[model samples]
Target: MPPLSFSEGFAIAAGLVQLFVAVVFLRFRHGRPEWGLGWWAVTFAAAGVMNTGAPVLLAAMHSPFGTSLNVLTMVLGISTMGALVAGSRLYTGHPRPGPWWSFALTWLAYLSLMMTRQLWPGYESLIANGVTGLIFAYLGCLSLGAMRRESGAGHGIAAAMLCLYIPMVAGAYAMGLDQVELRYWSAVPFALAGLGVMSAMMGRMRAHLRDLNESLEQRVADRTHELRDIISSLESFNSMVSHDLRGPLGGMAGLSGVALSALDAGDTERARRLFQAVQAQSSNLSNLVADLMALARVSNVALLKQPVALSELVQESVQHLELSHGEGHAQPVQVAPLPVVACDKALLRQVLVNLLGNALKFSRKAARPQVRVWAEVREGGVQVAVQDNGVGFDATRQRDLFTPFKRLHEERDFEGTGLGLALVRRIVERHGGRVGAESQTGQGATFWFWLPATETPI
Candidate 1:
């Protein structure tokens, strides 16, 4: 065994360092969709073998079979080039590398060509340099294609910079036989530059991963906050239902017992009155249950949307309201022509029905029970409003008016379950719209909703 020279020793050290880098990359990560770094890891590892041994082997050693070192060097160069090409393609989102056998067959051919050179010594330099040049040219052209396509950051930078150095490396290696001392050392600079660019690319990937982690954390936080709010809302809803139902249930129970006792004592009139009270309580309970179900459906059910002409819809809703309230049909409805909007027809019909009903109910005492239905064009949508000359509520209590089982007027004054407006808001919002109302005490109230003008609903 012989000791190493200066350049050979430097090459050996660089090769070991390259191997260390390869090991680090292999340990880094393998879960990415783009596996360029994975291919790159293989690249540095193979390169480590060439750098560490190629210099000494070519300069001093000989195969027992008398094979020239040129054969091995050419094969290694092309193999390294093949890995680079595959990695770049993957990074650029080109077709992924083919089956392992495809690469294996390619490697076998390279090895076969190297062996062929040993058999044909006269044209050996031509075979080796020519083949190696083709490999570099293929790599250079691939980099150029990727550059034109504007591949990913890592691929783009490496291609853009390393491509410029490819010709010099190929030219230097092509003259390897003539310049024995310079050929191996000449390739070192370009290889080092390529490795540097790869490191930059890997650094970019690390930064991107950090950004992804931050984004994931933010989404988790947002979801946690939303979950907490939903839990609080459920608690409040439970409390409201329990408190509201208790009074009516107790009244119905007490009224039933009283009516039974009155019947037993032979008091027909008292029994009839007590039974009527029980019936009213039963009706209230039924309405509350119906409203609760409607709210639940509104939250859970998917919408079926269609383009609705508001003018015809308003008239139809008004007619439905009039028929439902035979006496309140006297409340004349004045409507303005409105735009076409995309919405869930069934839900929008219910919204109009509820708004019109409120208008008629609150204005029953007016000299002329008149409800005005109108609409206006607005940015991104159309806004339809239902206005009435009625006993409007206080502005401060407006927010509470839409709450489930919250009635602004007494049952003796105006009968309702109070889920009407709440249901309206939920349905409208689900359709990507908004509902609001404006009123002053004793003045007319105008309840309005904005429907987006969408060509298609998804």
Candidate 2:
């Protein structure tokens, strides 16, 4: 109703500012309780309400009611301090107990004393100011320790402002200054402390964003490397198809023309021989295509893993090899107890067949050719080895053994499309395993693979 003073004008503006800050904190606090923004919002809201209400109530009610408003203001001030401290601890990841009891006890004690203010009148304001100042000092010390725990500009600023506020309150009280004068000096630092809190929250959010970006960048890098490897493999496959398939197709075409000429010249036997040569070439091409299909299948198929007895699979492979090649039936294969592994049974069977077939084929030249299959369990899982007593290859070139169409032996001595080991490698890798070979020229060779272990025994 009356003209407003400078301190009252400042108090109203500061209260509005604090209320606006509380609203902003509330808006950002959604789904982020860990940030402690909710507590900060309470701190500002309570301070804003007390600051705005105290002046209006003091003007309207000049007697005991006015005195009661002052006590209420002090009580709310303690609440704001508690909320600020709680928010600070939560933000820095060092939480403390709730300030409800302190608020309740202070309110009850002060209210009881205020009822008897006629007897103890003047001392109440001093006591209230002193108590509030001491608490603020304590909170400042807490913020100082928190600043040391976590490097943040906000904590330091809040501590400095709170600590600075104590001396101002003490000086004002000593000079017997009124509430409006006290509010004038205290409002600036209070507002700054709120800004400091906001700064700490912003810094934390920035750090979180930085970590997320780094993780995303690392994922992108890994995916890029994988895509590059896929491209390289595609290129190698195209090269092999062009070179290897063209030769066989060309030989077949040439043999067909030559046989036609022999038939025209009335050379029946020559024509028959040429036709047989063409058929052999056609057979080789078919085998190569089949191997290529298998390799592609291995790359794309999703694995269905189950416990399988690898020893049984090895025996079946040996029997099948004997039946298919005819001569390898005489080769003695010594099979040791093999561990049971979790894998796709069909794919794993194919792996055993290729490995055993190669072992028998390579070692059949020995006077007493022998093929040995054994397994060992190690820290890295189960390793199965197929060794042969045959003419071994150069160990230095062993890495190339699993490459499609890469061969160490002459075609005349050994018959193969050079894709068996490559297929073995792919199948094993698809099962989350690895394949390798060890050998020295003129000695024996050992081909080994390892698979993740299962609970099943040998």
Candidate 3:
């Protein structure tokens, strides 16, 4: 019912400010408990309760309950110091062991001492102020060191405010100041310390946002580069379609017309030969379309890897080539004991078929045509090679041998859409592998690819 004193009014205001800080820290903990904001919340809440309870309890100091409240407030104030130290350390990524239990033990000891306060008489105020001053100085030193090391404005502010409290605590204890003067000294610094903690949290959030923004910008730049590469590839694909597809289509149209004219002129033999040429062109067109589709599928389809014996795949590929050309007996392919590999079965099969087919087609004209399939196990992976004793290419001149629609020889000598090796490269790369070729003019050629020996689940 009485009017509030200056100290009481200031204590209430300080308590409100500290409670607000506690609520803010509590909300932060709710979102990210991993950051350990709960410690600071406890620190500020305890300080708020101590300050807010001081005014009423100070007036009833002579009573039994008042004495108990006084002791409880002193315990709360000491606990706030411990919690602040613990919270600051954890926030900076350095944590003390058993902070909670250590402080609990400290409170129990203080409580025991307070129970016998009648024996200490006038020294109680000196003891409490001295202990609080020592803790303040220690915290100030810690904050100062952290501020210098981390260049944090919050730490600097906290260090300055906490250090300010040490001098005021020392003066109050040395001069035997009244409870009102002591409360004023403690309340101002306590409010500033809360502000400093709030600043530290804001600084952390700013740093996090900066890191997130940088990550997003990096992703955007990488995506832009990938888009540019895709555009360039599409342009090359369009060019190849226009040039290569148009040639075969034009030839077929002309050949069909010429054969029809010969048939009308009653030249049956000439018409029959022309019709056969048209059929050949149509077959080549079909094969080209098939290779194009295979290339597209290799680029788009995800790899499904599994353990497979290279020997079985090699034999199957050879048999397929033999069925396609009917001259497999003349080529005489020798497949060595190939190592087992972990790869997409279908894609790997396509790679073997293309490599073996190339070897057979190129070497078919040799006097003693021979093809060999082999594998070598290296440190981290296995190397598979398809070698042939056919007319090899000049490796130095044919730099882009694996480029789509890039032909090393004339189409008349070797019938191909120039997409086979490109498809092989795409499939190998998709499996996290590498492809290479070794060749010399008039000698043999070896096309090799390397794949990881261990199976990596997709």
Candidate 4:
């Protein structure tokens, strides 16, 4: 045997590397049965075999089997091309390579023709070049189509694929013409294509990782918002419990001591009055604690929605007010013909009652004390309004209206724990609604809420 050329040694080294790559691809195929990775493994392994076997056949160039080995090399080249196309098609959902039977006929012709006469250096160069060119041209089109079908841009990849055709086929044809040496350069095309395939796969893996990262980031953002909301609620609860309960509790203690002093002086009337003051303070503390508990309950309870008649709810809320405050407490409440809406009835009832109660409470000293509850149909949803001829507030402070434990009026002026409107806001928001008030100082207020119209409960 002739001594190995530099080209042969390079080919052997390349073949070993390719075989190692094939085994790695095989492992990937075992891990993930998708993407036709097995075909890639086969193609790489086959290319390694062809590269390793080429030098032996080159040494026996004059022998008949040398020609046969050359033909087998062509078959291996075609197989690799087929595998490349198949894997790409699987990866990108692009079109498949042509049917097997069509290539079988061309391969048969090449094999049979070679047996009859040596065609490598003659007319066979043209035929082989034509076949190889056609294969590459087809693959180029598939790549171009895949690039178009893919959402992401791969202009460079498409350009590289389109550029592969002419040189690859024309260069092979030049080699067949005995114009190019078959030393180290014989396996260059395989190496180039192998590198290209590896690059494409790596790009695909990168895209997949990027998508996973984006999804994880979105989840983190959502969790962060929830965390912020929880912290805010906890702060509200703490401030409310400390501020609200402390004032009334201290008043009750001071009143108790005053009543004891009055009883020691034998002033029964003064002691009785002080005892009543203590009872009032106790009631205020009780109300504050109850409001706190209600706020906590609203946060935890998931709303169960149904179709509720707003007009009827308004009338019912008026009756509740009349029962609690006096028979004529709801006389000023003028409810409009409201539209039916999908919402939690009990929650919405609380909303109407709180708003209506506020209107009544604030308008109690007004000469007329006219209260109006109306509704209107809007583009995205329904709007409900509670207008009262009462002590209206500054519009600038409207932002604080929905905040827990936020009160615009002092407790001495308006008896409340500042949780009523906050609870109303929570109930509305839970039902996919938004609340806002429109008013100027002493012009009376129109507190309104917008509820999104849904065919069914979400």
Candidate 5:
């Protein structure tokens, strides 16, 4: 092809720049939901088309058609100002210029020029160009205000608007004095301004993506740690259960065999004693097995939530304690009315049963043994308290309370597997509740738990 004309070369360069900006705009369109930035992209792209096409048309046409094209360019210029105002308003969170006023003012200005063009064709282009330049200058001031206020996307757009307007301003000044070539170089800065805005938007998007990836990685790490803790707990539980049950079960079997042999040898008294010892050992073994199973079930069972009356649970626990200890031997226990809560009824009852049982067992030697159950309403939940005037444990020994097989008293003094409170804690926590105790040396102990309240059905 032959060497391209000035207008043709400028149009080709502007078109290429427009294509690049259009691609950038499209790429980030879905990623950023900010309306100001979106409008800026659309305005810049449309301006690019007008800038590229106008010059080519001016070069190809003459007289009336050329004049009409110039008028169309002036109209596009007014639209560019309106877009800038609206975009700035969005970025700054300020009230937008009324649409009706903007439309009326812009068209009124253009119509005055149209009439001027008909009356004085010679000066029409100059007047239209000056009016367009003034509109751009006014929009630039608004953009600068947005930048000063530190609006989102303001700095980048302000810089781009400044870059684009500076050349147009310079071209307008030169053109007033009949210098034409200066206006030709305006395309270069216009393209640079468009590129700058797109680059800023891309940078913001990349930062957002990086933050999202970091958050996802952190969540994965936390989940992995949780799974590891759960596995470790399960292994420890299995080891303890195996070691505890083996010796007791073996002894019961051996003792039963011995009792049978004694009876066969015709030693009646010795056989009777042996059989009694076997029965005691068998009962002990049975208790241990039952406790172990209860603990295991409590740990493994999933929480089933429903509205449970706390008073009823406490009453049931007290009745069971009374039955087990018997009226003659059992100490006086006091319980208060409680509010309803949302929790797993079975698990919560198990917790209360263990706590009350522990209190009764330890207080058997106390002169005035007492156990009290009550609840206090709290913000968003309720706190249930189980207090006992028993052989209270030391506060220093608090950590051992919820560990399996860690007994506070001797096995002879208290017949227990030392898993009751541990089971209580596990069950309470599974129901999204918390359990804790308050005690001092020789003083009474208080075990309390908090459960979230349930909303009443409408």
Candidate 6:
């Protein structure tokens, strides 16, 4: 109730400021959550509470509450020191000896002082103050040591801690000699030091986060380059295979056809069998050439992006497949209305053609062979699907299904070059899309791909 002294007023103001700062730190600290930061938060809050309660304790100098508050202040100060040490250790990724010993020592020293308070209260206060001061000094030294080791966030925090301790040491020295007037204003330096330490800690944390992001970006770039190299190699290999094998296959087919034609004019039954064998071999050779060409095209073709109507592409592919299959009385391919997508029209047409052709080829022996093409809009892209009631492959072997020359069925049952889906996958990926299939053994398969939608003109 009485008029407060200058020291009491200053202490109260400083305590409130410390409390405000601590609260502000807590509010923003959630943005960067780490073990080191948690320790720092505990330290700041404890220190703030101690400082804020100091004035009331000083005002009621002779009361039991004042005595209890003073003890609590010392306890909190010791806890804060330990927290700073632990926090520094955590930030630097260093392991520390057990913290229980330090806690035990602090409490033991505090209790000893309390036991001797009746006989030498002033001496006990000085000893307790000195002990706390030493703890802070030790923490600061440790921080300085960390700073010298490297240029990092930890180093910056260490330097800040060291700076904060300078004034604290000065205040402690002044307080030990009963110079209450000089030590009374020590809260200013203490607050400044706390602010410096916190700022450094925040700066270091931000730097570390930036470094982590940079490292991740570098790893991603490296992986991208690796993938590009693999794709380039695959393209070159396919081109070589297609170019080298085509000449020999063509020669063999031509020679066989000539030989069969010559034998037909001389002998009847023998000529017929020879001619059939030549036809089968020629068909196989043609399939091999087609597959090799498909593989080469998928690997090496450069895509030219343009607006393409999905329905038109599907119809074109269906027509091409029909011509290749010899205009049979097959069930007609049905294509639904689809949206326009941004892609290389030629490559996309090829992709659809191969998918549809595959569907038709595999479904040829079915009682009701049907192939359907459709498109659907999705988030960030559009999906095109070609579904067929074909002799589907095993889902478990789907990975191998896309590899060149990997055939599930025997050559006699299903005639294919086995590069169709592989080519489809390459073309879709080249257009910045993904291709996938869903099927079970005996059930039909759905081959689908997603392409980025054309952006609307402003």
Compose the digit string of candidate 5's lDDT tens values, residues 11-106.
558657865776667566666545366556566676677656655555645765877776776667667656655554554455546433554566
Mind giving the per-residue lDDT tens digits that candidate 1 earns over 1-458? 56776767766766776677677667654756474666667777887888787565664546563365566666676667666556555654555445244346457766777678868877675565565556545555665565565434444444444544445545656765354444445346435635654565566567678889999999999999999998998899889888878978999999999999999999999999999999999999998888889889998888888888777888788778768778457447888767778888888988998898898889888887788987777777778899999998888888887666677778789888778998889899998888888999889789998888743211
Better of 5 and 6 by TM-score: 5
**How far in Å is the alpha carbon of 23 misplaced in model 3?**
5.1
Q: TM per model?
A: 0.62, 0.63, 0.69, 0.60, 0.63, 0.48
lDDT by residue for model 2 (1-458), tens: 77877777777777777888788799888746876889889989988876666567667568667677667766777667667766656665665454444445545655665677678676777666666666667677777886786667987898888788778877887898886689765876787777776776677668778888999999999999999998997899789888999999999999999999999999999999999999999998999999989988898888999888988888888777778878546358898988788899999888888888787788878888888999888665788899998889998889889998899999889888889999999999887889999998878799999998655456
Off by over 4 Å in 2: 1-151, 154-201, 211-229, 319-323, 326-331
lDDT of 6 by residue, 248-350 (tens): 4675677577667767677666666656776776777777777677666666767788888787777787777768776662355778778888899888888
- How many clashes show up in model 6? 0
lDDT of 4 by residue, 1-458 (tens): 77887767888776776777677677767544556667768877987876777676566666868778666766777667566556545545543453344345445655665675564555665565555556556655665665565443442354355456557556755666342243345355555555555556556667777888999999999999999998997887787678767888888999999999999999999999999999998887888878878877997888888888888889899999999889778899887788889998888988998999999998988999999988888867888999998889888998988787788877788778788998998898888889999988888999999998833211
Supply the global lDDT for candidate 4.
0.74
- Which residue pairs in model 6 clash with each other? none
Per-residue accuracy of model 3 over 231-316 as CA lDDT, tens digit each:
99889988987898999899999999999999999999999999999999999899999999998888789888889888888878
Kindly report which residue stretches of model 3 are placed more than 4 angstroms away from their true locations once superposed. Answer: 1-15, 18-90, 93-152, 159-194, 207-215, 305-343, 363-390, 397-399, 431-434, 448-458
Task: Give the Å shift of residue 137 in candidate 6.
Answer: 1.4
Deviation in angstroms for 188 in model 1? 8.5
247 in model 1: Cα distance from truth in Å?
Answer: 1.8
Clashing pairs in model 5, backbone N/Cα/C closer than 3 A: none
| Model 5: lDDT of residue 279 | 84
Task: Report the number of clashing residue pairs per model.
Answer: 0, 0, 0, 1, 0, 0
Q: State which candidate, 3 or 6, has the greater lDDT.
A: 3
Candidate achieving higher lDDT, 1 or 4: 4
